[model samples]
Target chain A: MSTEDILKQTPLYQQHLSLKAKMVPFGGWAMPVQYESIVAEYDCTRHGCSIFDTSHMGEFFVDGDAVKSGLDFLVTQPIKDMPLKTCRYGVMLNEQGGIIDDLIVFRIEQERWLIVVNAGTMEKDERQFQKFIRPSEKFANRSAEFGKLDIQGPQSRALLNGLIPDIGQLAYYAFDHFDLLGANVLVSRTGYTGELGYEIYFSWDRTPELWDELLKRGARPAGLGARDLLRIEMGYSLYGHELEENICPLDAGLERFIDWDKDFFGKTALLKKKDSLDQQKIICFISESRRSPRQHHRIYDQNQELIGEVTSGIFSPHFKQGVGLGFVKKELAKKGDTIYFGDDKNKLPAEVVSRPIYKQGSLKS
Target chain B: MEVVDHYFYTKEHEWIHIEDDQATIGISEYAQEALGDITFVELPSVGTEVEQFEQCSSVESVKAASDIYSPMSGKIIEVNTDLEEKPELINKDCYERGWIAKLELNALEEQSKLMNAEEYRNYLNTLE
Candidate 1:
């Protein structure tokens, strides 16, 4: 059989097809890349509300003590001190200090937790959890049973408030269970897009109905294409792009999310590599024009010497130019540094800028 | 899907409209549709010589970048400079205003190697 025949499909697949979405294979699932033009959807996500089908991501339920169940030692964050109904973002690392996956830990209850991970690393992440936690009915991978939708924009709160009257009470990164479509649904005030948004998790079978209702409620449907552009504009790291098993969080400039006060899987190795002088760090750049720097495009210094490689890039709709993230030698990873990207024959000049090239987001609004 | 009748097309989904010895070239509607939204177009320099089926210009969309090959050998006489600021013209009208470059033909017989509109429509069917 062909590889496409074995790919997984979400409950909203038929809905996306009906909407004339362009489908593509991503991380073992047949997902929608775009419904209409990416620029149109991107504008709606920034100025208005747009709903996204994020069912391809993996979700896990863990129950027990934070430290005794090995959950505290598994992730590189302070999970034990998290308030109930709040979420924290961090990474899980291998023994050698390489990142395994970045994930979000949601404290559902005093002893119960919810972990959300990338779709590509779902199986491996499940194994890592099972291997560490004590064998019991305390852990379960519910990715197949749940479907997720993100309604994001400055107007998202008002739009969703019509359905859930108490949605406005939740702070950023906070979550609560509410009755929707006759089923208990978990809704969080968080999103990948740099906008006011809410992520809703519901039963897989009911996702199609949820998608339809959102569209009917004036929330335009957006796909992965717009999602990628939104995240890139916010300087967010995606799995297999800005992050991977071979890259550490510190080098990715995610040191703020790492909890150094606690003992974790890669704590010792990360400590030894902390003071390394020649470590490379992730840097952000803005192109001189609409020409974008693509993945694997080599970065060049002022002297025309190869310095690094681009990991993620996209034409910023807000900035009206190309912006990207790349890894470079620590000494060269400075703001206001001039760099060039692309091949020797077509070296496009760009300026290194601080992260989040589009800063005037409604994320905090 | 929008193959202009009487126009000659290449296997790579490019179309050429010939008027005597001068020919205009652009990508087909199928090509533009496959490339979500045209974000940028790197047009070739005017007066540069190009060979048939060789990469002359390149186009970028939100998804990826693709090389636009010349349909017939010639020298580039004119290019659509409007695409520099508004590449979406190609996505909006891949057949008419979206024409990439105009070439002064160097070979007339090479047109025999290309497919007519009807043949190109049939060729697009095989892809599906």
Candidate 2:
């Protein structure tokens, strides 16, 4: 509550307060945690269409050739294979291979790219880009000038098609600029909820005008509470949680995103660490009971031996059971291994299955 | 929030309905609403003895896992096993069908420390 004076407010801050949202300090911002209830808001995102204010996320524009601007070597995922108007998910890493942040690079123009990063690591990510980006290339951190909104759920496509006629043509991981309400907005067919949706980046100052329009279109306002739950159910990686400065992409189960075929930042470190012994890898689990695995809760084996720690967790409303993502010793992280969460006082039983505990989703649909 | 007039309440938001030496216990409506979408309930054993205001069983909702304290000291007589697979009953009917446990009162005088419906209503206001 004391941080209210210092925390930055988005353009829709007043609107959120008017709706009686439960505001919380997130990533140094006074953001809405939930407008109604976390569960109700989550249900809307899964079944019905819901709009989320994600303007706090970072966006930077780069104008130059991929390799010439030093963008290719900066991220782990390969950029040469991406066609125009497509985006790929990857991570920026430190020299020691520690994950700086997970991001999406959208190749909008032939020589231009739009990169989106997490809200918590925006400043640090910008500093890294400014440090590595070479001369003769144009770069702009337009995070402050862009307001992002994600409309997600099974009903998202139909609702958005009513606004943008060509929304159906935009494939997953693709984007296009369109004139909407007399404003040029960048709409991407990508979302974190594992649902059929779009992430719209609008002009920051005039976004509230569009937010009002979207509300009239029957998109209920969801909050960060629902967003977190949705992403967790899909076993998605969050910056501060699954992908931290101390954690590497390999340990985070994101090696598939890394391009070993091409040389990039932290390549030598990654190559060396790949063969290192005793490395812990991230794994997803489902609780036998309804006891949700909370952050920082230690993970133990069936014998009560300590293995690792839980990074993200929630009681999945879709599954009617607890689901969580955690990092455990790679050797002990088996598909059917029974894991327990909690410390000495107690241990909640769970089983390590394949990644993504929630099987029912409309991500690709 | 639904508060039974005849029930005794605790500061931790648990309620108990006493009939002779037998008592039924469950979390209050305010508690259920606060911990939305109850997912799992850890029912206490039948013969366990519990102290007033002490930890009896725990319930996990989508928001959090909270300790359900004993409203008054007693020996657990029976538990609602139905809650194991139908924990949403805590959210649907927390007062009646969602009752957690039944206890045989060991010390009837311990009830004095609890609040009546009127007193509990006032205490709930102080929380806000």
Candidate 3:
């Protein structure tokens, strides 16, 4: 299929083109891969402010009391206690204990909630919500009605404060309604990149204006390439990679998000797997060599025995090294173990280090 | 974009500079620009024999990996060891210092099958 035929365009598509972004297919959307260069854009995000078009993500509105609406039982994270204007990060699992998608739940009001999901899994997520949410409760899939943009970096707050004076007060994981360009929009202090940033959800029709306004304020345009690198540097899992239909939260190192104390889908199966898990999905690593271990690259022990495989790998611009996220046998998932990655033609030495390969982030600041 | 007047070009964006029985090879500037910030370059061993248009080496950028094809059949006489430590050199100067390998040409006649510098520039325009 032609690039435009299979890919959906965001409101900022023209903007990206205007900036000479390298556009590529990502999650069935015509997304920008880079504006100037991936390394340059990555640096811009780490050191300055960068704006990303995240409109491809799915957004759903759930309206009702948490328990009465079946919203409380649909996700793995505890949502009933989430304060208004706060967001919770968690996963949605199938009956077999495999993850459906990792999602973020935003508490917009006492009876209203907004759930954001991965772009590729939008249809499935909507179907699952429709199937499980009680018919008596009111909800709507508002994915098409909203456009999302993420403004991230150490200078993000300073940049955003120029547009919305109170944006600086929204602490990490918190969100609030603010007036911008004569529209009341939702701005949340949360991001995939481990940088102090905000994810803005605005009216779809107003997105082009917001995008232009942000660029006018000196926020550099970043593409999906930089986004992937930024997230991987933070040890964040992409949906299809670390979390998939065949992987459960327990094996994916997301046990903390799963509330075993309360009932939810896949709870019983997860409990069963928890007892028999031979391998744990964890973020393991390699050195700063330019040689990156790509997806599905076999992970081997010091003795060259295959133990795991990389799910996501990239050359981190900030660290100037190769880093990856992968799953390994439970015993080999330790932080300080040595490992190697192998492909058909090469076997490179590496070491298993802690997640979030680059630690000096402005995420909380 | 820097197609040398005396060099021959391949559709895959490789360039060859032939002098007598010896030929120098590298990817075109357009190819390097498309690849973006090359991080790793897997250079071929010095004595490796390669066929015309065959994959001789691999180049990796932050986003993807691509193979470098031989523009002519030859025996690899010397590989660019500088790329082992500085792959970005390919992005900086893909035509000169970034040349991937030096080869002893086996079939000099194959040079005629490749495009001239002006022809290669025209080919790039057609791609857009």
Which numbered prediction scores highest in TM-score against the true structure?
Answer: 1
lDDT of 1 by residue, A49-132 (tens): 999999999999899989888899999989999999999999999987888999999999999999999988898998899888
Ranking by TM-score: 1, 3, 2
lDDT of 3 by residue, A208-275 (tens): 99999999999999988999999888888999889998899988889889777788888888888988
Instruction: Name the regions of candidate 3 deviating beyond 4 angstroms.
Output: A1-5
What is the CA-based DockQ of model 1?
0.73
Instruction: Pick the winner on lDDT between candidates 1 and 2.
Output: 1
Give candidate 1's TM-score. 0.98
The root-mean-square deviation over C-alpha atoms between each candidate and the true structure, in angstroms, is 1.2, 2.7, 1.9
lDDT of each: 0.91, 0.89, 0.88
User: Whose lDDT is higher: candidate 2's or candidate 3's?
Assistant: 2
lDDT of 2: 0.89
Model 2 TM-score (2 dp): 0.91
Q: For model 2, what is the error of residue B83's alpha carbon versus the real structure, in angstroms, after optimal superposition?
A: 2.1
Q: Output the worst ten-in-a-row residue range by lDDT, candidate 1 chain A.
A: A130-139
TM-score of chain A of each: 0.98, 0.97, 0.97
- Candidate 3 chain A has its poorest 10 consecutive residues by lDDT at A279-288
